[model samples]
Target: YKSGQKCVKVIVPENASIDVYGSGWVCNSGFKKSSTSCVPMTPQEIQKQKELEKALAAEIQRRRAQGVSGDDCETEYKTNAEVCVEITGGDLDCNESYGGDYYRDCDATLRYEVSTDYSGGAYLDVDVECSIEIEYKGRETYSTQTDSSSQDESHSLYAHGSDSETMNFNFSFSSYKEITSVKISSAQCEIDSVDLY
Candidate 1:
């Protein structure tokens, strides 16, 4: 009885019963009181909690072994490495753009010159075609260097078509070891396609 009220009937909750002295409620055998309710803490629940704690401890140990820790940790091991082998060049000596070897005319003194012209467009696709006459493998063959170049003219309204620039390309044939002589002729550049944006 409280607040000046007289005791009438006792209200007992589930998983709970009257206390030992028969004054108030108490949680039953394996249950615990939580605020206004009784919660079960059976043997199975205790076993599951123990297993979870064991698994958590094992996981923390594994993580700590794998270079992960809170405040007290250090690197487990160290390593030193060195390069054993190194490989180098087969790049073109003349123009890095041009590749492969061809027998050419020695009249140009082993050098080839070409000029490129850009048209009135936002972009220009040009081809620097050169006649290659190289004496390779005891035979003379004539071929054309159809290497291409693309130029951007985005900085201006129209590209200057008259702006001509001559680029020189050198030639050498180290593979063909017969009666030797390589002479690259003068190359010519022409616009393949013009783009305007």
Candidate 2:
């Protein structure tokens, strides 16, 4: 029965009957009840909980120093090749019987160069593109037939094409951690080296 409630019913069993009403129960000598729950914590238990909290705080601080954040950095590579071939035929071919050696042939080597730069820890994405422009004897040639026999290829950060082509790419990372280094595969182009700021 509660402190202020009434016990309105009573029945005694033939075999056993025990009834205690209007009485308060006390806890053991060294135990105490708080609200509706029991709690027992020795000094060791309390010390262990404090130690766990301190270790958690230290781990969080370490992560912050490692530059964990919502920002990200990205990198990409691009390549291109421009080839020009100049063939000089010094005679108007009239007949094979014309005994005059007046034909000259000259060839110039083509060069391909690739360069890259990055913004340290500030890069959200990257874009790469390559273009080829052919100039013969100080004249711009827009015809693709001029270099039809030439073959070019690229093996970059994202391998795209061959034979003097343009490729565009974009990349994203998880955090704004500074870029450490960039590596390029062995290729047949002049690499100007990557720069980071």
Candidate 3:
């Protein structure tokens, strides 16, 4: 009796063929062996991968040419870029409280002057916040408020060729409590955008 009939059948992997000696399996002509399986990688597939890499590189180069960072601006405008505008002056006007040391019905006007470096013309969206502190009967109270100079929600100011603009904020204290003193504790400005024309 021949033992050949008792030999176990070898299972061939997909996309692969049995070796000439019938001892193992090898990947087909157009496929490559990956671990225990065959993966197809024709000449056309290699060409497509190369094309995709080239296109991605071209996109990065185009954005660099336009002065745009890979992503949007990450920091405040004035700190990240050259400061094209500055607060030249600040004036406060207020009405005296009736028979008290405090003043009410106040208006704070901030003036901005554009630098000569950007004389071409620009639109700026600036946000200003000021902290007001008041003392009443030996206790101090603080408050912060915001106002936009632009017609829209964004506080935009358009300046052309070394121009300047003023922003006004109204502050009124209606409480009948007797206040001792009213003063502006701190003030800060954050420039959102500066678009040059």
How many residue pairs in model 1 have overlapping backbones? 7
Off by over 4 Å in 1: 1-161, 175-179
**Reference-based TM-score, model 1:** 0.23
Two-way TM-score contest, 2 vs 3, winner: 3
Cα TM-score per model: 0.23, 0.19, 0.38
Give the TM-score ranking, best first: 3, 1, 2
On lDDT, the leading prediction is 3
Give lDDT tens digits, candidate 3, residues 22-42. Answer: 666666755655556777766
Q: Residue 94 of candidate 3: its Cα lDDT?
A: 45
Name the candidate that leads on TM-score.
Answer: 3
- Model 1 poorest 10 in a row by lDDT: 82-91
Better of 1 and 2 by TM-score: 1
After the best TM-score superposition of candidate 3, give how far the Cα of residue 153 lies from its true spot, in angstroms.
9.5
lDDT of 2 by residue, 26-135 (tens): 22322222322223434774565456446645744664588642112223332222211111111011111112121111122223323223223422122222222221
Candidate 2 at 131: error in angstroms?
A: 49
